[model samples]
Target: MTAIGIYGSAGRMGRAIATIVETEGADVAGGVDAGGDPTALAHDADVLVDFSTPAALESHLAAAVAARTPIVIGTTGLNATHHALIDRAAGSVAVLQTGNTSLGVTLLSILVREAAQRLGPEWDIEIVEMHHRHKVDAPSGTALLLGESAAQGRGTTLGEERVDSRAGLVGARTEGTIGFASLRGGSVVGDHMVVFAGEGERIELGHRGEDRTIFARGAVKAAMWLADKPAGRYGMTEVLGL
Candidate 1:
C-alpha cells in the first residue's frame, strides 16, 4: 500500500484528502500544517499531496524533491514563478498539478477544447466560474485551466488573449480572445462553464462540483498512479486516461 503525506493537513482540502486515505487503501504517512516540517513528512511518505497555500509551495516541492517522492499539487493561485519551481522539481520527482482535481472538470476541459477547435474564431469564447464564499482567487484556477484548453484549440495561449474583467467603455470583444468572469458567494462548492458563442447558436460545456470528496478521490487516485512513475509532470487527463 502507498503511504501518503498531507501538506496543509489541517486545512479543508488536506483534511478532505485524509478522510479518504483509508478508503483508498493507503496509509496516512503523516501530515503537516502551516509552519510544520514538510521535509520530514516527505521523507516518511511514498507520495505527497499538497493542498497548501501558494506561500508554502516552494518548501513543499523542495521537500518532495529531496525525498524523491511523488507529489500531487491541488493548490490554486499559482503564478508563473511557482510553475517554474514545479518544472524544476519534476526533474527529480514525479509531479502532478491541477487547478481542480475533479474528474468531471478534467473531462469538461477536453470537451471545451474540442468545441473551440470545431468552432471558428468568429465564435467568441468565454469562461465563467464561481466558488465558495471563502475562496480567495479571482478567475479560479479551474477557469484558467479551461481557458487554456480553449486557447489550445484556437492555436494560441490564454496569456496572449485573455481578459479577466471589463468596466464601462470597454470596446468590442476581440476575436479569438478568451474572456473570464468569477463569482464568489454562498457555500457553492465549485461551478465552471465555457461558452462558445457563434452567430445563431451557442455551445456551452460545464461542470459542477457539489462536494470536495470528488477532488479528494481524484487526488488519491492520482497519487497512487503517480507512485513509482518516472520523474516528470502530469495532469488529471493522464490519470483518467482521457
Candidate 2:
C-alpha cells in the first residue's frame, strides 16, 4: 500500500486528493495545512501530494526533501525561484510538477502542439481558459502551459513572445504571436481551448473538466508512478507517457 501524505489538507484540491487516494485503495498516512507541521506529516509517508499555494510551495518542497519523500506537486503560479527549489529537490527525491493534472488536459496539450506545428505562422494561436470565481491567478498556469506547447510547436519560447489580454486600442493580432485570455465565474471546474485561426477557417482544441476529481485522480496516479522512480524531475506528460 502506498502511504500518501497531503499538504494543504484544508484546501479544496488537497481534500479532493485525500478522498481520491482513499477511494483508490491507497493509504492516507496524514496531511498538513498552514496550521500543522508539514515536515512531520511528510516524514511519516512514502509520498507527498502538494496542492497548495505558490507562497507555501517552497516550504512544502523543503519539507519533502528533508524527509526524503517523493512528491507530486500540482500547484500553479510558480515563479523562477520556486522552480529552482523543485529542481534542487529533484536531486534528492523524485518531483513531479504539473500545471494541470487532468489526463484529458495533457492529451489536449499534445494535440495543440501538433496543430501548432502543422498550421504554421499563418494560423495564429490563442489560449482561453476559465475557472471558478475563487481562483486567484489570471491566465492560469494551464493557459501558460498550453501557450508553451504552441510556442514549442512554433520553435519559439512562450516567455519571449506571449501576448496576454489585448486591451483598448489594440490595433490587430500580430502574426506569430501566442495570446492568452482568462475567465472566472460560478463554480467552473476548468475549461481550456486553444484556437488556431487562419484567414478563412478556425481549428479549436479544447478540454472541459466537469469534475475536479479528474485532477485529483491524475495526481494520485502520478504519485504512484513517481514513487518507484529515482531522484528526478517529471511532468504530467511523462506521467501520461505523451
Candidate 3:
C-alpha cells in the first residue's frame, strides 16, 4: 500500500484528503500542520499531498526534494514566486500543482480552452466564480485556471490577456481580453462559469462543486499516480491522461 503524508493536516481539504486516503486503499503515513516537522513527514511517506498555505510552500517543497518523494500541491492563493519554486523543485522530484484538484474542474478547463480557440475575438470572454465566504482569495485560483485555458486557446498567455478588475469609467470591455469576476457567499463549495459573447449568440462552459470530496479524491488519485514517476512538473490533465 502507498504511504501518503498530508501537509496542512488541520485544514478542511487536508482533513478531507486524509479521510479519502484509506478508502482509496492507501495509508496515511503521517501529517504535519503549521510549525510541525515537514522534513520528518516527508521522509516517512512514499508521497506527499499539500493543501497548506502559500507562506510555507517553499519549506515543504525543499523537504520533498530532500526526501526524494513526489508531492501533489492543491494549495490556492499562490503567486508567481511560488510557481517558480515548484518549477525548481520539479527538477529534483515529481511535483504536480494545480489551482483546483477536482477532476470535473480539470475537464472544464480543457473545454474552456477549446471553446476559446474556436471562437473569434469578437466573442468577448468573461469568467465568473463563487466560493465560500471564508475563502480569502479574490478571483479564486480556479477562475485563473480557466482564464489560462481561454488564453491558451487564443494563442496568448493569461498574464497578457487577463483583466481581473474593472470599476467605474472602465469605459468599454476590451476585445480579446479575458475578464474575471469573483463572488463570495454562504456555504458555496465552488462555482465557475465562462461566458463567450458574440453578436447573436453566447457560449457558456461551467462546473459546480456540490461537495469537497471530489477534490480530495482527485488529489489522492494524483498522489498515487505520481508516487513512482520520475522528477518533473505535472498537472491533473496528465493524471487523467487527457
Candidate 4:
C-alpha cells in the first residue's frame, strides 16, 4: 500500500485528497497544514501531495527533498522562481506538477493544441476560465496552461503574444494574439474554454469540472505513479500517458 502525506490538509483541495486517499485503500501517513510542520509529516510518508498556496511551495519542496519523498503538486500561481525551485528539487526527488488535475481538462489541452496547429495563425485563439469566488488568482492556472498549449502549437511563446483581456476603448482584436478572460462566481467548481475564431467558422474546446474530487483523485493517482519513478520532473500529460 502507498503511504501518503498531504500538505495544506485543512484547505478544500487538501481535505478532498485526504478523503480520496483513505477511500482508495491507501495509507494516510500524516498531513501538515499552514500551522504544522511539513517536514515532520513528510518523514512518515513515501509520497507528499501538495494543494497549498504559492507562498508555502518552497518550504513544502524543501521538506519533500529532505525526507527523500516523491511529491505531486497541484497548486497553481507559480512564477519563474517556483519553476526554478521545482527544477532544483527534481534533482533529488521525483516531482509531478499540474495546473489542473482533471483527466478531461488534460485531454482538452491536447485538443486545443491540435486546433491551434491545424487552424494556423489566421485564426485567433482565446481562453476563458472560471472558478469559485474564493479563488485568489485572476486567470486560473488551467487557463494559462491551455494558453501555453495553443501557443506552443503555433510555434510561439505565450509571453510574446498574450492579451489578458480588453477594456473600454479597446481597438480591434490583434491577429496572432492569444487572449485570456477569467470569471469568478458562486461555487463554480471549474470551467475552461478555448475558442478559435476565423473568417467563416469558430471552434471551441472545453472542459467542466463539477467536483473537486476529480482533482483529488488525479493527485492521488499521480502520487502513486511517481513513487516508483526515478528522480525527475513530470506533468499530468505524463501521468495520464497523453
Q: Give RMSD to native, each candidate.
A: 0.8, 1.1, 0.7, 1.1
Error of 2 at 22 (Å): 2.3
lDDT for 28 (candidate 3): 96
Query: RMSD in angstroms, candidate 1?
Result: 0.8
Instruction: Tell me which residue pairs clash in candidate 4.
Output: none
- Candidate topping lDDT: 3
Model 2 residue runs over 4 Å out of place are none
Please give the distance, in angstroms, between residue 238's alpha carbon in candidate 4 and its true position after superposition.
Answer: 0.7
Which residue segments of model 1 deviate by more than 4 Å? Answer: none
lDDT string for model 4 (57-168, tens) is 9999999999899998889999989989999999999999889888788888888888898889999898999999999987898999999999999999899889987899
Give me the runs in candidate 3 sitting further than 4 Å from their true place.
Answer: none
TM-score, candidate number 2: 0.97
- Which candidate order results from sorting by lDDT in descending order? 3, 1, 4, 2
**How many residue pairs of model 4 clash at the backbone?**
0
Residue 93 CA displacement from its true place in model 1, Å: 0.7
Steric clash pairs (candidate 2): none
Model 1 lDDT tens row, 1-242: 99999998898888999999999899899999887888899999999999989999999999999889999999999999999999999999999999988889999999988988888699999898998899998899899999999999888999998998778999999898999999899999999989888999888888999999998999989999999899999999999898
TM-score against truth, every candidate: 0.98, 0.97, 0.98, 0.97
lDDT of 3 by residue, 137-189 (tens): 98998999999999999999999988986888888878999999999999999
Q: Candidate 1's C-alpha lDDT?
A: 0.92
- Candidate 4 Cα misplacement greater than 4 A, ranges: none
Model 1 residue 204 CA deviation in Å = 1.1
